[model samples]
Target: MAKYSLYINSDCSLIIEFEEEISLELSRFILGAKLAIEKASLEGFVEAVPAYNSLLLIFEPKAFQVERLLQETKELLDKTKSLAPSQSTRHDIPVCYHESLAPDLAYVANHAGIPTEELIKLHSQAEYPVYMLGFLPGFLYLGNLNKALHCPRRENPRPRVDAGSVAIGGDQTGVYPIASPGGWHIIGKTPISMLDSSRQNPAIAKPLDTIIFKPISLEEFNQYDH
Candidate 1:
């Protein structure tokens, strides 16, 4: 069987799904395949959007040649290699895990059977890899949350979760770039703007980048804000 299978998503879209579960290696390969497809510049190609274990290819509907494109994609991925993680950048994000900002910190800590301080330490100790950004504007989907910190989303989602809220939902952790209704258990808040519309590149980080949360005091959070 083929490692990947392509399916028509729409008249203008095709999906390439890998026959594997989500993993760092799979993530790298997915990203690498995206870059390779972009470089191929196939006729009618529009963009290649990557996810944990799949890639979505869009094209000009009128110019789409299904058979030709499928063959081309298979050949491209076959010759393509996983992108080097060394080329990725490391982002040290400051997070204030104060009780005032972290409404669910104690809750998550309790669920994990660990003290709040220890929970923060465990959350900050590991480096998370950027998987993809979606489901919310500028929301970065980061992976590698510590198993101890893993907790289910809140039973009732907040009507409005403030931006910069660092949260853990299920097995993932990330910072909300904008205020929106959310169910992720908030454990902290960051002072930096993860998404700034004025900037040329609104998203602070991209796929293949690494992020590390540095715990900061509320006073330090105030300092960063000012």
Candidate 2:
């Protein structure tokens, strides 16, 4: 990985870029940078947010000058190069793939020329990585779906997707934590509250978390709902 000069934004943010594309290595690099920044008790360091191919470092000016922090951040980035990848935390998310639950199951199955059962099997088999949290609160963008299952977004997006709606777009899979307009083909729904703002920890998954979807019956989902 080639390291470039650190980029400082007027918003008290610094960006250290290695690559411009998304990959396992890039994700690991983002995580490594995150860990390094968090570990440093720099007076002005506010928060570090990781994206598809870069990390955003936020700081305050009163406690730490931008110029000094920029140098310190570059040092931190250099240190991350020697660190190991994060040991991922696995989360088994339960999904109910019933016809009633998965409105787009028929369409997705037809598009792949596969039976619905096979479609469900393919979806639940892979261990997806938590790429980033964006677009919505606690809305996960997991990657590496079985390529055969890759499909385009709905031609007409629904005005309001149900909360806990599990859907797929292209080669990525995600869960809708709140009802909102969505274009991803809905294939299932989970009872898990991935984003409960009332809870101390609102987001259920974090960057580098491994997500394994477990299929459940509608009856089982109802039982958990209660």
Candidate 3:
């Protein structure tokens, strides 16, 4: 059994936080709870947002019932299990890790005591799961970064990181999704559009989705129809 705590975040919101390190099992468990809550259609329930280690449940302010809802949620979540991995949508995203596209490739490689090509090789080989969407309109927090590729966030966050920039910060790697100020060390760039507000599902991927990075040359990247 996992230890967790539920607390009123606001009059219209409650939070369930798991006291555990972030992991694939935790992500699956949290998302499972979110799906179960969504399925239950609890009274006044608006939505349940799941992250790496927690779930934030929102409800109609006027109909808020914190105590009852907490108990009900505890019961609901207790019965929930990790979601099946097969349900995850998989994407093989292409990335150009050339020096021009990757400003910190050499720096990161040096930090890991490996050459840039080896660093790229290690990064591209691993499969990363989208733990959550946040920080920007469609930014994905990817998990399972190769430990050798792990490095600290840049001391100076850039004022603007172009959309599609694949970066590493702490223990996770992710794509920028959209142009924005960021602190992650950029190591490559993808050409895919990760956000489209016109669509009902604005994000290109969702929690539990898996992304595989495929290294591409500058010519191939330029030829890609973005």
Candidate 4:
């Protein structure tokens, strides 16, 4: 455990920094602070974002001054630190690694010095932690890949990676939320839509959520996609 120091970034934003390495514990603490502040319903508190080891608080000056908000945030952080890490809902996503869907399968395999079949097995077997969503809307950065399967990002980012593409970049794996330019080495893709703006809650996963992908055949994938 470490002591947190609060600092003012601007009139409306305050940052609480945890003097610790970026890990699951730190992320949970950030989430705890978020939950606490939300529970308090403190006026002027607009939003909160948790990164690897710090929490950023956004507020409105009309409703909260720097001193009041800092005190309120500190109290919430104290309460949050005492609580245990909260368990998040897990999502089991289905993916298909067939030829047409996974263009970078062979490339990643070659880069890792392993056969494509072995690479797929290692990737599918691991249970990954959803670290956070960034890089794009609903784009999840999952961590702790099999060491043997680890590789770097694409030398040249693709003009547009199709939506649903599940790819690996370095130690992290991610699913493209929407069709966009990306560099992750595509190994497979899920049939499920990563994000549907029409939904009441658009993002399928959030911080601290555990995500596992089950391998399916092309037929099964198409069955679900339709």
Best by TM-score: 1
Over 1-226, each residue of candidate 2 has an lDDT whose tens digit, in order, gives 4354578765667876664668777787778778888999777788888778777788885664877888888788777752254477899999999999999998999998999999999999999988888899888888889988998999999999999999988777899988999999999999988887887658897877889999999999999852
**How many residue pairs clash in each candidate at the backbone level?**
0, 0, 0, 0
Candidate 1, which segments miss by more than 4 Å at Cα? Answer: 198-200
Q: What is the C-alpha lDDT of each candidate?
A: 0.90, 0.84, 0.90, 0.83
Would you list the clashing residue pairs of candidate 3? Answer: none
Tens-digit lDDT track of model 1 for 135-184: 88787889888988889889999999999999999999999988999999
| Candidate 1 TM-score, true structure as reference | 0.95
Off by over 4 Å in 4: 82-86
The total of clashing pairs for model 4 equals: 0
List candidate 2 stretches off by more than 4 Å. Answer: 1-5, 61-64, 81-86, 198-200
Better of 1 and 4 by TM-score: 1
* Superior candidate under lDDT, 1 versus 2: 1
TM-score of 2: 0.91
Give the clashing residue pairs of candidate 4, or none. Answer: none
lDDT of 3 by residue, 60-120 (tens): 9988988889989999888987788988999899999999999989889999999998999
